[model samples]
Target: MIHDQSMQRRRSRIRGLFGVTAPTDAPADAHTPVEGERARLLDAIRDFLLGNNLDISAANLLAAHTAFSGGNPRLRRRIGERIAAGEAISQFWLDQQLRDDGKSDPATHYEDMAVRLQSSVERFRDTTSSARNAVVSYGRDIASQVETLAREEPAATSLLREKSQGMAETARTFEMRLLRAEREAQSLREELARARRDATIDPLTQLPNRRGFEAVFEEEFRMARSNVEAMCVAFCDIDRFKCINDSFGHDTGDRVIVAVGELLKTMGTGSCHAARHGGEEFVMIFRGFTTEQARERIDAMRIALGKRRFVQESTGDVIGKVSFSAGVADVFAFPDRRNALRAADEALYRAKEAGRDRVEIAG
Candidate 1:
């Protein structure tokens, strides 16, 4: 009996840690071993994490639970073989994942922390309310006693005056506490908003990273679908990027990427978004633009970049010009975003095959 109780306790603790609910139904046999149930639950959790290509670290596991529970479609769609390959997930990988999802912004974390803090604030408020009520009730009781004392004995009036002075001080303290709570809540909200914006932006190019691009793409795609407007997606890659990196070193290569990003940013308007889609690659979404319009814009950018010269800072040697190739696809042409992206990729391949510095439109 003691062993059974201990096993039950262990199982309960495991369930609590994993955010799993305890079984409501009793076991068929009283002799059923608790180890079996515990192992089963643990195995199931491990399998779920591995299947989803999520890291099995404590933080990641909890994040996985939250993602699954909240039905985060972006994270859901991102699950792939790369994450499921049984490699240890490092902090860098987590950050990369965040960047990919456009969630590199601190805002999401801030929001989560704010939510938890809000709950704590609510509970504290409730407790404060109860305490305030108790104080009021006590004050009322003291007033009644003082009133009785006045009728029975007038000498107790001075003592009642002292108690009233103390009550006033208590009220002031309560008011300060309430004010502090309000300030804290407001501060947390602002911090969360700031975090979100910072997380989505890439420091190198000062542009939205892959995650940010995904967010913009999804929004633009939805808007286009609803309004029946034309939308285009373009994939741009620096031509001979490897050659640049090998010839001039990574620092110069980075400078080229930054320069390209800036140029893309200039081309962006309210209806357009430019993003750094990882190393040497960029993505642009043009709202209310057909494939041809997108192709024109991309070609223009390519030619402009080709005309611009880059000089190596250290040696003062002219590094010559940089160019890029791009593929443009009409969002409405394909059945889904994935298909459209695949088509754009194929077009990009063709552009590379034909020559390095041109734009190709998806058929």
Candidate 2:
């Protein structure tokens, strides 16, 4: 799985480095002068950056321009900030910003970013003006050839053109089906993967369910034991989840759960896995971290979630906010995974008994 992720990242980096190559029927030997055009484009972008006193490299500037032109504000802001800061372009920083922003406002952000890409397009347009003219010239040349051929061999020429047009249409239809099939296949694969994930996930919150957590817990525990390493478990429960469900509709309650789940997943990175143990309860396994580390991480997550205002999706109404109480414990103290889970649960119970929206660690 790590290898697959690494491979995908490597492939993405490679593609990013090369830029996207256009799919074409043209032979490799066909000299399209696109490489030269690209070089000129890069040079123009560098000149623009230098001319504008935007402290960005050519590649970075190009990426920013592309993102802006593609209408991504997140990217636009990122590029803008880096240039403003006089910092070197950082792909990682940009990516983290995007991830932090998450799935919300993708279209709006991208559209705003695309505006910045106009400069790149303008450069391309200028460079390709000659190419466009040449294309027109070629069209005239083809028209002259067709006329002469029609006069010399009217019947044969007419039949040939008709056959060519029919073949082209047939090819186009086939290509469209191929594209559709590819899209459908990709969708099915994603659905199948989702189903498999769902099997290991809690249906309500869609977090890794008890079964998934246990399996992962056992593996991490074993690794920790063998290495004489420290591991921690943090059990969390949404404060007043039942009350919220009772007050609001179950649908709204479900949305809250999903939002909380997302928050946990993001914040629980240091904690190996975040799982919906059952009901409003979530369990986080801090695989290779000490009790203190896990506690700090969970505390940070608790604070972040407690502060976030969750809005209702359907009507764009604010649905108030939510918070969780968590309990952290060392796995080494437990005889088994179940014992560790129980210890975390007890701590969580103590947290609820005292006050919610806080972290309580097992002594």
Candidate 3:
């Protein structure tokens, strides 16, 4: 009851700030401005999530709630622009935007987990080392005392020596166990590191997944900012991918995905860093390249890729020519990295609208 009353008081203050007031005798069901706005926002968010066929997952709910409630002006603006520009708010795109804005933790979560695990391993190793040292020291002290006892008391020699030897064996056994445990801990630490790396890479493409790409981009973006360098990021998507899958089956789709992955991997060998952005889309970044230069390079790649013919391995029948469309944005053109990607995505939408199998530069 106290919390509800406090919340009501806060609402009243907010309403007063917005030039709204409740009458002295207003009914409980009265629709105040703040209450009405909240109701409308709730309705709008529901309509949006359901209408777009987006999952009702926690992240989506939080993002939508924050966006609709005007908590994040940039996210709200970006979502509005994408809608206005005829872009679908796909799950992948939403996840990308969330990651770009640092709202999502999926990308760096593995690293965070690894850090904690590594710290634990280090602590365990330290504890084991201390225990091992203590046992060894204890065993040496026992042996030294037993030898002195043997020298001083010849009659008690047999019993003292036996007890000392038993203690020495126990200490050795414990030390060996500790050593084995420490080795296992070290192996676990290495495995954790590998797990972190694996999490960031796409299994299908052996390319950096969205999270890994972000990690690379973050470093590059930071350096580009510090040195004031030219950089470009492009989004590449297969043209008529759905039609291909429907016509030829999903096996063909997987093959197409792999084929694109191989090309992007090859491109990654150059100055451009490439990644499979998810689904039929890939992302690439080029340093020391103007937006125009990047667009030309991407266009040439597209043309060359279009020239290649894809044949089904099993059927040996030629699948129709596979092609891709791309959108390039100058990293420096926008104030931040996310906006640049959004601009690139918008240009990609325009390219699709114009016709696929081409490259478009962001304005």
Top of the candidates by TM-score: 3
Tell me model 2's lDDT, rounded to 2 decimals.
Answer: 0.61
When summed lDDT is taken over every stretch of 10 residues in candidate 1, the lowest stretch is 72-81
Where does model 3 exceed 4 Å of error? 1-57, 62-122, 147-158
Q: In candidate 2, what are the lDDT values of residues 1-363, reduced to their tens digit?
A: 985664444333322322222222222332445554345335434433443334575545655454433223224333433444455544566556556443332332443344455444444544454454554455555556666777899878977576555655555555555455555545655565554445665666656665567677777778878888888888787888877778666788887778778877786554378876555667788877888888888888888887888665667767576888888888778555544655666577667667788888887
Report the C-alpha lDDT of model 3 over 17-37, residue by residue, as the tens digit: 212444232224426755755
What TM-score would every model get versus the actual structure? Answer: 0.62, 0.45, 0.70
Q: Which stretches of candidate 2 lie over 4 Å from their true place?
A: 1-198, 203-205, 268-271, 312-318
- lDDT (C-alpha) at residue 301 in model 2: 83
**Across residues 230-343, which tens digit of lDDT does each residue of candidate 1 receive?**
998888889888798898888999999999999999888888989876677787889889899889888888888999999878887888989998888887886567556656
TM-score of 3: 0.70
Error of 1 at 304 (Å): 0.3
